[model samples]
Target: MSALHIALYVTGGIAAYKAAPLVRAFIKAGHSVRVVMTAHATEFITPLTMATLSQQPVALDNFAPPRPSEVSHIALADWTDVAIAYPATANFIAKIANGLADDMASTTWLATTAPRIVFPAMNGHMLHQAATERNLNQLGTDGVVVAPTGTGFLAEGYTGEGRLLEPAAAQDFVTYVMSRRQGRLQDVHVVITAGGTQEPIDPVRRLTNRSSGKMGYALAAAALQAGANVTLISTTGRQPPFGITYVPVTDVRQMQQALTARFAASDIVIMAAAVADWRPARVAQEKIKKQPGQETWQLDLVRNPDIIAGLGAQKTHQFLVGFAAETQDLIANAEKKLAAKHVDMLVANDVGKPGIGFGAEDNAVVLLQSGTAPQYLPKAPKTTIAAQVISAIAAARTPD
Candidate 1:
């Protein structure tokens, strides 16, 4: 991930103290932190304290203190990668939801195109109020991330669900959101398939491949960071990450069904899963126990659905990206599949190559599109490759 610059909004709440530690944590993790505290928030934590911790001037004024040419609110909002509202009170949440810019923080939020995250901390009753609930819902509907609150002792000497997450956990939450964020993909629905599908034979035996899902997962993460809503159909053994939809499948049929269900709503569909070419013709009712002296055992194989070709046959408005992992005739075979499957673009690689493809953390690929020359990306981190793919897709997309 690139180095991040954060605009941390501190609102009026006892949890404002937690924001102080969070600033240091952000700095320690090599991210830039700029604090923008509400006038009321100064009562709970001093602006001097926050500034000292963040090592930057606190933004407290609506306009520049010395140079009004620089609108403090808008400048800070535009400068940051993403903004976090720690100890976001119901009043402040309402202000943000309804577009009220009475204070510098609200005004900054209104002006920012970057992602906005709110960490609500208030009295339990205030948090539970219908207005607060409504504002929170509105924020989510508007694509803002609402961090979860914890139940703990409030400054009021009572335990409730409105307490802010601790500094450490809050830091992690910020990292998670930032890691998955990409402004280009914002609000765009994307679906991706990853890992090699498993075709079970008996209860204990199955056929699979070397696909680690790294490339596809990288694509999913990259699309997510680009601000696209993502759903991952994974055959990899790993669990899915938070914030995106995940559908686990073990066979090609399951993957096909999942893709069919999701493809209609997707703006882009990436077929990255390494589906099995064949499966057992008959699955034994129980494990096929080996005979003590069995010398000959035959297993029949059957062809699986050509998922990409099927989707391509009924092409729609969605941009389709297909991957070709070949051991021979790399470009020729890939182009054949691309044209045959009606793929909009093809990412082809030699899985047999050392240090690239399959389970490797890096990749080298040739990108082929309908009307463009082949674009070659040399070996690089999967995340970097993913960014390149998403950037290319964004460039190719028709602007709204």
Candidate 2:
């Protein structure tokens, strides 16, 4: 993530002390922060403390010791890239929701064009009050993000909801919100498949490949960081990170079924799973046993359905991406599959090379698109590769 200019608004509440760490967290993450505080907030945590942490003077008054050239509130509002209200009291929440900017903090919020996030910190009862709920809902309608209050011990000597989030968690929430705003694929629904599918021959035996599902998982993570809602379908048992929808499948048919169910609603589909080309024509209920005279056994195989091609044929508004792990004639074979599968982009790599493809942590790939020359990406971590692929997809889908 890139550095950001963050405006932290401190409101009155016992949780106001938490704002200091939040400021440090943002700065630690390479963001510059400027704090604004309400009168009640000053009682809980001194402006000097915030100023010392943020390395900037805190804005505490609408008037007094004013600048000669510009209004402080408006200047701060205009300078902000993102606004955050930490430990927002019920009074402050209502004021912003209703556009009552009696104080400098509220006024700056009203005047700012940057996106806003509110972290309500009040008594559990006050937070769930009808009025507070209505105000929060109004803020949502006004395009403000309201962070959910954590449930835990409160200042009222009781354990319940409406507790402030820890500095680390709050920082994480801010990062997520900021990423979504800056992300090119914001609100895009993406579906990706990973790992190698298995074709069962009998109850105890199955056929699979060496694909470790690393590349596909990388794509899912990259897309998510780019603010796309992602669904990951995999045969591997690797646990997905938070914020991705996961569906586990064991074979080509199961993967195909999962993809088909989500294809219509997706804006982009990436076929990265190394699906089996063939499966046993019949599955035996029990494991095959060796016999005295049986030296060799024959298994009947049938072609598995081409998953990507089927989705491409049915695509209405989705951008399709397919992957090819080839051993020889990489470019020619990949290009052939690109056109055959009807994908918008084809990512082809030579699995024959050691330490780069299949189960390797790094990859080198040639990106293929219709009528365009192959673009080679040097060997790099799969995460880096995935980010580049997502960036390329975003550029292709929304050309200037």
Candidate 3:
């Protein structure tokens, strides 16, 4: 690829140090680069260090002394081909998502029209929080590409998915984005089911699962980044990321109906929701009263609709992916499901495994393809896992 102009935005996170090496990589790749930092980011790393490494003076404030013009933000915004925000803080992410230009860094970000990418770094708990995840989804919807965070030691002394990407990985992602001639998944319509379906038994009582919906949300975000039109079907109360059309359902039947209506228009369907297997035989119109000695009351249950299998039966040309969450004999059970559902691919994980299952930010799964040995992925964040799944699906669709 020819040398291109690049702008690097640093945020306040422990991973800010990674920006130095990232700047070096872009220089080594024959690209012209400039560095910009949020005021809070300066507390983590010095401008002098980034300047020395990038061979360009780091721009900190929108209006610094001796500028030829007062609008430095506009000048910087207009000069870049691609802009990247590394170690993007949750605060900055939310601001960008909401179009808030409260600071120089955010103002420049808002002023730019170039393709933007964000590499988020934070504590695992913050990364998984409802608000942070929602902002990330919004960024994706707004056409900003997010590189998945890695798992490792955090400044907060905890370990999980909020670690920033290694310098090498971040560089590769930048190159891939800048070198692409055409967007992947352009004009493709993708429907993704995420989180777990809830089955209400009473006004307040319901049955749900531990699914956080991170994996499915990540898939939708990635699909949007790859230039695909995405529709997210979710049962979890979390909001869908910014770029997706969301359809929320509380029961398996409702989910089935939603999918049935959209499946024909979709080029791909990923059934990532952990739908309830059974539901109450009757849902009381009002809250069931608790009476003395009522603990012995019995309620009947019935099997819920089989969403994936139904889609598989009705699907003709669309690619279908299913997920299998198992406790024991994971592969064997997943293989059975693969055959039973006639899915193009099955991602199976052992939820019993520590730190790699439901309600956790990371997951270790095996991708199963018919007549081929299963491919195992070590424990990693759901975002990275989603990327792997997206790559696999793309490869499967490639002509031999």
| TM per prediction | 0.72, 0.73, 0.62
Each model's lDDT comes to 0.87, 0.92, 0.86
Candidate 3 shows a clash count of 4
State each candidate's clash count: 9, 0, 4
Per-residue lDDT for 1-400 in model 2, tens only? 5678899999999999999999998887689999999999999999999999999999997875678888889989999999999988999999999999898999999999999999999988998999999999999999999998899988999999999988877876776677676688899999999999999989999999999999999999888878888899999988776567899999999999999889889999999899999999999999889889998999999999999989888899999999999999999999999999999999999999998968999999999999898999999999899989999999999987
Candidate 3 lDDT, 333-391, residue by residue in tens: 99999999989999999999889888899989999989989999888888778878887
Write down the worst ten-residue block by lDDT for model 3: 175-184
Which pairs, if any, clash in model 2? none
lDDT score, residue 396, model 1? 81
Worst 10 residues of 1 by lDDT: 61-70
Superior by lDDT: candidate 2 or candidate 3: 2
lDDT of 1 by residue, 328-376 (tens): 9998898898788998989999989889968898998989987778899
Q: Which regions of candidate 2 are displaced past 4 Å?
A: 1-3, 12-31, 37-68, 98-104, 150-160, 163-189, 195-231, 234-250, 276-304, 313-317, 326-333, 350-363, 379-383
User: RMSD for each model, in Å, please?
Assistant: 5.5, 5.0, 11.9
